[model samples]
Target: MAIDDRVGQAGSGVRRDLRDALAVLAATPRLLVALDFDGTLAPVVDDPEKARATPEASRAVERLIALADTRVALVSGRALKDLEQVAPFGDEVLLVGSHGIELRLDEADDVLALDADERQQLGVLEQVLDQMAGTLDSVWIEPKPAGFAVHTRLASERHSRVAHLVAINELKAEAPDATVRLGKDVIEFSVRSTTKGEAVEHLRRYTHASAVFYAGDDVTDEDAFVALTADDLGLKSGVGPTAADHRVAGPAEVASVLSLLATLREAHAADAPDTN
Candidate 1:
């Protein structure tokens, strides 16, 4: 499936049903669960570092991991090392970090190398952003191991707008080889040719998931949601116009849906006959 060209209205009963369907998919035998980290799994907080998975959500994810057929992936903007710090079950969930630029499973040192152009551009952008940082206050440039983010979240309302414009202009001109991307309060410049949509496609093939269910709350995550087919599920985390098939109130609601899924999985396991 291609990126959904149709950007639909954000709220509707139809959107709600999609979230309901995601709860159902969570119970299926072969599950490929992909989630965006920041505003989806953890609540949006003042300090990004304090953003940790809620205890209940973490526990539920652990239970879901216990299911033999389930495969979970944490797809996030953070670098692999940072993602590892906050994820619930260490190494249990496949970590697709740096906007899927790097992927790893069960090993810290283990990493999937990014494409050649991405490798070269990332090096150049790192230096350029650092030099421009002093001029852009509240517009700090976050240097991930694999990529970089220009954040305007801390900027005053007027400066926030200015910061975005300045960063976008600078990144485009300086990092000609990199992919410049826009998001909520941030602009990401990466060397990866592959977008989030492509990341989902790779995971679909790797896990052979019959149905793909992806959830996220940011603009960058829309690419993945748009990539979903009719059979797949795409859930939006907040109130807004989205390409996602489903919509939820917030992170707490996402946890509830996940918990319900675990219950359904346990019930299914109990019903299956044991050969032993």
Candidate 2:
């Protein structure tokens, strides 16, 4: 069920449910807070460089990180360099980029390495997508490490549909084994099949988190949502059919939710018994 829009209300049943979940997550030995950068932490924008996390959301992330047994990560479709450019965070939060094709555990971590075969495949993919965009008004190609995404966010309805159709047909003929993913106004074709779900699972094991709180706002995020289990909470940040357990209107509501989690986590930490 959809909760209150702001999540700033007091004594609402929906609020209580979310509050309880956050409390349980806080009390876990290790809690991993994973989020989609675009449309989840920041408002969706045509110019990706313009997107930045809401102030309240940024504060909440810092607060949660200060608390014991807490970790935060940004799982985004942007390339690692692109994600880092927009996200004003340091090494404090892990970053999973390119829909899990790239992972930035820390600044010192090695970059993604591709073999000769993969490099040749990427070159061909880029050329086809480049041609697709050159022939259509407002169609754009976004480069990634393993593949590229055809962005139709700026295209007219007819042009957008034509771009998608052409991309699909061309991929079937040119790169039959390429993995394709559909998102809001975009279609991504990857040489390597990877997903946000795999990234989240990897983070879970890597951090040894007892519970995971993940939020996202696109169809591709369903891959991550479906990966969630009873110990996890999946939140959808926009209007669409979703596998997420909860829904919010948009980025503003997401900020409120994160702020609430920060509050609940602080209280839970205060109440816990001392192990020492």
Candidate 3:
């Protein structure tokens, strides 16, 4: 369906709520806008490495970055390096990956360091995931800095369930302290305990943002949504039960939201009286 058709399906109440959220974001002195990568800014593809932001979304992001006092960030479950390969935005935008365990701020890069024990545990996780992948057709394991992810997007329902069960059980037995997160057709195991919520809070403090706007599409993003304050806005890109204040159809709608925010912020900046 066309973007306009999808947008037209939104109820009046949702439109009003989105308008109100954009108003608060536009008026804030410093604004932080964080978005999830796959399935939020970009359509989730069969091959994770092939994912890229839609052209419309990319243009909207550029506009947001150009706005004064507005900071844009992509907080994703992919590794920082992998996210960089896909998005490839300039230093003006922040990139948080591996669910906040890895951060690339401006020109500096920060990653979670694993101790000897954690390294050993991660090796075991990789072995277990490899074995599970071997057993299940179309299931693949993605290695990460802290741990690994089992992707079942292309697997049959039965195979996906069995693979996830095996991986989860193995992780519980081998790396009992590992942080496990379940999302759409994927299961991730990491040694670090960081969450997207923590990442959002960190960005908010780092940027000294008066208000924040966060959007995502997966269950993993619920953490970020819950972290939002009264002054902040949370948008769920797709549907299901979510903690986000508003819901949009998919990445297309997300792009529209970004465009709306950029337009509103530009207007607010134009209307502001010059202090100098």
User: Clashes per prediction?
Assistant: 1, 0, 0
Model 1 whole-model lDDT (C-alpha atoms): 0.73
Worst 10 residues of 1 by lDDT: 1-10
Candidate 2: tens digits of C-alpha lDDT, residues 130-223: 9989999999998888889999999999999999999999988888878999999999999988899999999999889989999999998999
Angstrom error of the Cα, residue 274, model 3: value is 3.3
After superposition, the stretches of candidate 3 with alpha carbons farther than 4 Å from their true spots are 1-14
- Candidate 3 per-residue C-alpha lDDT over 123-227 given as tens digits, one digit per residue, 9 for 90 to 100: 888888888899889998888899998899899999999988898888899889899999999899998789999999999998889999999999989999999
lDDT by candidate, in order shown: 0.73, 0.85, 0.87
- Which runs of model 1 end up more than 4 angstroms from their true locations? 1-27, 106-120, 274-276
Q: Who is ahead in TM-score, 1 or 2?
A: 2
Candidate 1, 134-165: lDDT as tens digits = 77666788887657888878888887787667
Error of 2 at 265 (Å): 1.0
Residue 140 displacement (Å), model 1 = 1.2
Q: After superposing candidate 2 on the true structure, give the runs of residues whose Cα lies further than 4 Å from its correct spot.
A: 1-14, 274-276
TM-score of 1: 0.84
